[model samples]
Target: MPFYHKLGKIPQKRHTQFKQPDGSLYHEELFSTIGFDSILSNAYHINPPAKIDSIEKVIVDASPVEWDAGLRPYHFKTKGLKFELDFITGRKPVLFNSDVIMSVCRPESQMDYFYRNATCDELIFVHEGEGMLESNFGFLDFRKGDYIVIPRSITFRLVHKTAPRLLVFESAGPIKTPKRYRNEFGQLLEHSPYCERDIRAPERLFTSSDKGDFIVKVKKENKIYSVHYDFHPFDVIGYDGFYFPWIFNIDDFMPITGKIHMPPPIHQTFEAPGFVVCSFVSRLLDYHPLAVPVPYSHSNVDSDEVLYYADGNFFSRKGIDYASISLHPGGLTHGPHPGTTEAALGKLETVETAVMMDTFKPLKLTNFARELNDENYYLSWKD
Candidate 1:
């Protein structure tokens, strides 16, 4: 049986601290099939077991801090968040947190580990390549554009040797599939603009039992530790459910067509309480008597907007590069450059592609983020 909590409706003040049977810190209860809403509570689930078969022990309560800031951003919680490990590199599960940590990985790096705050659910976006995900329920395939929600503490691993790259969405609280898209019972309504059909789960099932010395890494209280496991964690034989490693391709994002192109609201792919992920793909420009394909300049007085330039020419902004992130926080006026807006005036179509995430709260910059910076981004708007 899978564990659940009515997170969407549950008041902020009320929360049940999930714990291990021993009442230690915590131990996730694995489930074979989870409904969309049931997952909002506790989504520690897998597909049916047939998709998975392996040998290893599951290590819970891991946190690997990729960075330690002398003064971290306000958006980051100084409190605590738990994480898990899944080695796509065929290593033991590992998780840890250090004031300073270095993870220089190649295209072959797997989960190794990640952190999830108590308040937010973790959203893993596959940016490139293909792979198989082994979970408690079963095995699931992950290809480009899939948004895998490992709601909280589901211990899993990636088994693809392909070029692996990821876009990770870390939320402070429960990340929910928009309720407006789902019916009262939490079922994705038939009329829902994007139904569950658009979500892709895993398909290939492969398991192994090579045992020498499996090292499990765990992070707690700003520290990282490693332990040895006798068996492989992918040992699951079968599972079935609504919760598992599913995929939602950016290409399948239903474009909200309109005579006059709409605002960023139309491209939204995933949402939590304070954040949203949107895909900006190839599409026809707006058709109107006086439509400007370029976004209008405006002031963001209350929130911070960070757009990670995913791919392609980001809508006419000259010299935009791949993977270059631009953040516009509150207290700034932003919009298309003077000529850029006018340049888009006569445009009839757009082949540009970009993946943007608008965070509701202001984001603090890590020293590393600052070091790998685009300082003159603001100056690009002028002639």
Candidate 2:
């Protein structure tokens, strides 16, 4: 395969030196920014001015999308779980044609995220399942949280192989870590503030046996090509680098607060470029004299906002299910369904739950997403 840069037994790479008491640089080739899923886009990217020297402003357009076809997808089925892929654009859904897309993987065991492909960095939200990911970097234990930038080129597998996991994959654009978290110099600031240690990089990369039929799918020219390797991709015994899986737990998020709370900032994590992720964890209502925990209604004149209901009550509207998402496009108004807003205020406290992701770029609704969707979402809140 052309995308297959088979490094043979030894991939061309130098080990990082934090260099050991005994001077030795091993061929630690495993953690090389797994970009196995790198892709060219049909959308336009624009960087707005960064007001805070640390924060960056990026604007994206649907132009990068191959609207003529839409997105592509990957599907898998393990034991306990079923993986379904719904793509917005990649290829015109003409069976087996795609690139730049999304995939949902449902696994049976507490599968070690224990493999890597120098492709497909993931902006993963654990829609279900709990536990940790053991990597060469460290151990990241999380349940139902949004994990962004599990880089493509690195090797990793989920640990505590028990329950199944619901994973979403966006294959077209790179799931970049935020750039503001690092200086132009690449060092995390005491204030840029999340550090490298905060991210769970693998402490030691493990090499796998190349004796099996490893059917790795490689995407090129928007088409997926299957390459059979004599061994598994996780053949590296030990490796290290800036490339690895780092986790930001939703609960660990240090939210910005004031006498009056501020709205969510787009630049929440990154510790990378072109990517910013935030976790909407379970939180107590604000202590303001008068705080409307429920969102107010207004047409978005600026950017498109998307919210994924990961877990919890989502502020009073009952009967909520997992993996529910709401997309309020620009030039449209949305608010607390209807009666919920007024009823919400009467209650002294709320145990609402949700995970929201707002994309500055407008996202078109996929036919599948539109189908599986709770069509009643928009009208459910009505009195």
lDDT digits (tens) for residues 1-383 of candidate 2: 00111212232334233222254332232322224443211100011111112211332222223223232211111122243321111111211112223334555443311344333455565666676564333445656653645555333456534343444544444454455555666566565434555554333334444454544443333334444455445544333233445555555554444344346563265312222345555455556777666657766666555555555677634445465445566666666655676676634444434454444454554444533444445555456
**TM-score quality measure for candidate 2:** 0.64
RMSD of 1: 10.2
Model 2 regions lying over 4 Å from their true place = 1-104, 109-119, 130-148, 155-160, 171-177, 187-197, 209-212, 270-276, 316-319, 346-353
Writing each residue's lDDT as its tens digit, candidate 1 over 84-179 gives 223322211111111111111124445653222222244655655677765533466777666666654455555655764455654555566666
Looking at model 2, which ten-residue stretch has the lowest summed lDDT? 41-50
Stretches of candidate 1 exceeding 4 Å from the true structure: 1-106, 109-120, 190-193, 204-213, 218-224
Best by TM-score: 1
lDDT of 2: 0.43
